[model samples]
Target: MNLFDYTRADTLGAAVGAEGALLAGGTNLLDLMKIGVATPSRLVDVTRLPLTRIEEHEGGGLRIGAMVRNADLARHPQVLARFPAVAEALLSGASAQLRNAASTGGNVMQSTRCPYFMDPLSPCNRREPGTGCSAIGGETRNHAILGWTTGCIATHPSDLCVALAAFDAVVEIAGPSGTREVPMATFHPLPDANGVAPALAAGEIITHIRLPDPGGMARHARYVKLRERTSFAFAIVSAAAGVEVAQGRIVNARLALGGVAARPWRCLDAEAALLGQPPTEDAFARAAEQALEAAAPSGDNAAKIVLARRIAVRALSLAAAGTPDRMPALPASVFEGDVHG
Candidate 1:
């Protein structure tokens, strides 16, 4: 990696003020720098600060510090009991060793894992503004299917982010502008017409993710990720859900999808469809259909049409059954249920 000035901030203010590229785990940043994709004059390491605590907020919600490692968050009792989807996503990522090195804040801000964007030779608007996107007609099997524009088709790569959107988690940011809260849904940018490419703003450091009180319903959450391998690969299509059933009727349902969209996708149409309906196989199928109504599949990923639908249905079914721990073995055609706790 290129030489850069390193500083460990003593306080939040100091961390926010001493600027260059904000470094947490350096999982993504350092990797990019090593490959010459990102070269920074300075590296502000904030992991030493006291932001690693995970606490129970009032009203049964969760307040997670930005520096909490991915493994710690996934294994925490509070996360296991409350946000099973979030925990499952974290554990499903990388290996145990990488998770131990990855911080919660770093995961939230990790860049899109597009192959062409990272390769210096390829044309990518996200990497070099106005250069153009090579994924549009190149090896785009892993590109986005929804909310994509001509300029960018790269998908957001974080599974935990998808689950956060499902639970309506908001991020707390303390920066040069002072403290501000950003809803998870709006935290990632969507593909737009400007052709300026899609990405989060520079210099914004994530400090905490504020999880809204699940209100007795978080215990029944599920996360399902489909990948080429059984584990440790980015999702091909994933679903995260918070669902509750009362008297055989669906009382509440929240869903977020990943891999198929440019950002964490909240399935509002699916939520509306399941609000008063019975939580059954057919109901779940219909909800999945409604959720994917806006999907526009392209490139070699047309199979995602069926894959995404199945994950959504299965995740909702498991949530309605109130089983966060076990499920019937997933078929070979679908994902193996190993990473989800």
Candidate 2:
């Protein structure tokens, strides 16, 4: 890593105005710096700030501090009981060692895992705009198959964000202009016509992530991930699903796809289709179809579109079945249960 000034801040005001890169767990920031993807002249450590509490929100939901570590949050009583999908997403991320150090804010702010953007030698528009995209006609097996532009086709790499988006979580931000809240749905935007992506102001610190009460959603939720391996691997395609059923009829449904686009691709259309329908193979298949109605391969990733749709159906089916009393021995694997659901 390059030489940079470092200071630890004990207060939110100090951390906000300290400028430079806001450092928390250093799980992603340090790696970006080592590879030249980030070159901050100063590092303001916010681990010392009072943003580590996981308190109950006014509306019977959760207010998760940004500094809460992944492992702790995953095992927290409230997270496990109320937002099991969120806990499952956290446990399925990285490894035990990295999870112990990674923070909630850091995970939400992580950059894309596209190799082209990581290589300083490559011409990546996300890294150096107007330089062109190297992944255009190159290796794209792990790239996006939905909502991608020719300028960039990198998929977001966050399991936590997928579950957060599906559940309608909100982000709390602090900066020179004071605090503001943003719905998680639009927090990570898809590439516009110009392919400019993501949404986070410079030097703004994510104070907390507020999760609204799931109500009936708590009893039925699941996050299913398809990867090259059982653990410690980024998803090839993943789905987060929550279902609320009344008298055998679907009342509320949430579906979001990860590792398929620049952000967690929430399927509002699919959710609408599932409303009032009974949770069954045919209904889930139809909803999955609506979810991928606009999806087209950005490159030679046509198979990803198929795989993502199947995962969506699989996730929704499992969620309708109801959450397991205990987390699976292996979190989120298709093999965790029957993949052919």
Candidate 3:
């Protein structure tokens, strides 16, 4: 806790304007600051702003305010019943206490959990604009494979965000320019032309997230994660799936993966494979295979290629069958798995 000026903002406009840095739950930002990962001169507290709400949209979508706690969102009966994948991903991450404090907006805006990016002494382009990224050559076992550039290899680490991508949720941003919505896939950008960092600009704040209400897919959805530990750890690979089934055939399907790319990795090719196909293990496996068609795993993370595929297939299979696996007990030990057919 370094000495920093703090302001409590009561409105979105006030909060976005009064910021040196915006603090919601202070879960990610404060942690980064404590370890010298983030050192801002000022802090604007947005948690007090009336942004915490979860309501049904008129067009069958769900509007989630930025300040809504992760625990609250995960436990919301409507969310659990309708968008179980979203709730599952939220509950599967962190601990109950941390979830109670973490907000949907903060979680969406959370930084990548790259070790080099977090270490001040480490050479990371994201942390230092001109400094070279050591992760590209150094310890990159857990780094990104898809959407990675020669300059950076960090992977995004939000399970909730990955699910949001699958749901095609849009982030509601409020800043000096009023409020606008950006699709969740576009909300978090890949390492820019500079090759070392994300693309979020200054003065912009994520005010809320809007998820399209599940139609038939609400009946079948799941989120699965594989981590070093059950609780309080980032994912090695995770999957979120929403399957809409009619009779024995699949109608609509979506899939997203975390800890596998620069942002929430959507498997468009995999998704295309499931359209109009029978809801079977073979179909799910093919979809998973198509999803990883262009994957480029790095260093010790080569195993992620297999694990990502398996998780994707399993998640889709469960969703298609309308039966998800029970959440494993924590602290969960990681297991070695394969993805090849």
Candidate 4:
């Protein structure tokens, strides 16, 4: 790694005021630096800033600090009780060691895990805007199937982001111009005409993530990630779903998909289809079809269209069943109390 000046900031103002890349957990940033994908002359360490708490919001919601570790938030009583989908999503991500070091802000801001984007010799539009995209026709098995431009077909690899989108979370940002609140749906924008993915502006720093109360849907939420392996693998297709059902009929529903879009893909059409309908296999199948209606799969990734639909139907079925025993299992090692409580 290249030599860089390092400074730890104890306050948000100091952290945002400093130049160069901001470091929180260094799980993704340091890895990118080592691979020559990211290089900074200086590193502003924001891990010590007072943003590590998970507290209750004023209106029965929850506020999670940017520095709050993934493992901590996943097991917190408030998160587990109020937003089980969030907890499940975090647990479904990287291994226990990684989860202990990853932070809420860093997790959401992580870059795509595309091989071409990480390879210096490869032509990746995300790495070098006008260089052209390698994933468009080369090794596209794991690339995006929705909201992709010809310049780039990369997908965001964040499990927590998909869950947050389903919950309609809000992001709090602090910068030189002061503070602003951005909805989670709008926080991670799709690639623009230039093919560059959206990112925090010049001096913006993530402060907190606010999750609205799920009300009755709190007890009926699920996050299902279908990866190549049962552990320590990125999702090939994943679904996060929450629904409020009354008298065997859905009242309110929220659905978001991952691993198939440039950003977390919220399915408003699917949610609308589920409302007032019975939560049956046929209903879930129709909702899943509605969700994937806009999918534009490439040659190698055409299988993902079917896989994403089946995963969505399964996730919705599990959420409607309300059976904890039937929920997907975490890794056996994670149960050792090392990462999760």
What lDDT does the true structure give each of the candidates? 0.81, 0.87, 0.81, 0.87
Q: Which ten residues in a row have the lowest lDDT in candidate 2?
A: 332-341
Top candidate (lDDT)? 2
Kindly list the per-residue Cα lDDT of model 3 for residues 1-341, writing each as its tens digit.
57899887877768775658888888899999999989998998887777776777766888888888887777665676678889889988999989978888888888888888889898777887668777766777778867877667888889999999998898887767677778887677787545544444578788778888888888688898998888788998999998998877888999998998879998888888899999888899898888888888656677888898899988988787774443432221111111000
Candidate 3 at residue 333, lDDT? Answer: 18
Pairs with backbone N, CA or C atoms under 3 Å apart (clashes), candidate 4: none
Clashing pairs in 2: none
Cα lDDT tens digits for candidate 4, 1-85: 7889988889888988579898988999999999888889999999888887777787789988898889888877767777899
Q: What is candidate 1's lDDT per residue for 1-341, written digit by digit as tens?
A: 67888777767777876768888888889899988788789888787777877776888888888988887778776677678788888888888888988999889888888998788788878777778888877887877878888788888899999999999999998767777888897788876643443233455577889897886567788888989998679998999987788887888899888998778899988998898898888999999998888777657777787888999999898888774463232233221211212
The total of clashing pairs for model 2 equals 0
Error of 3 at 224 (Å): 0.6
- Report the backbone clash tally of model 3: 1
Which residue runs does candidate 2 get wrong by more than 4 Å? 193-198, 327-341
Off by over 4 Å in 4: 323-341
TM-score for each prediction? 0.91, 0.94, 0.92, 0.94
Write down the lDDT that model 2 would get.
0.87
Better of 1 and 2 by lDDT: 2
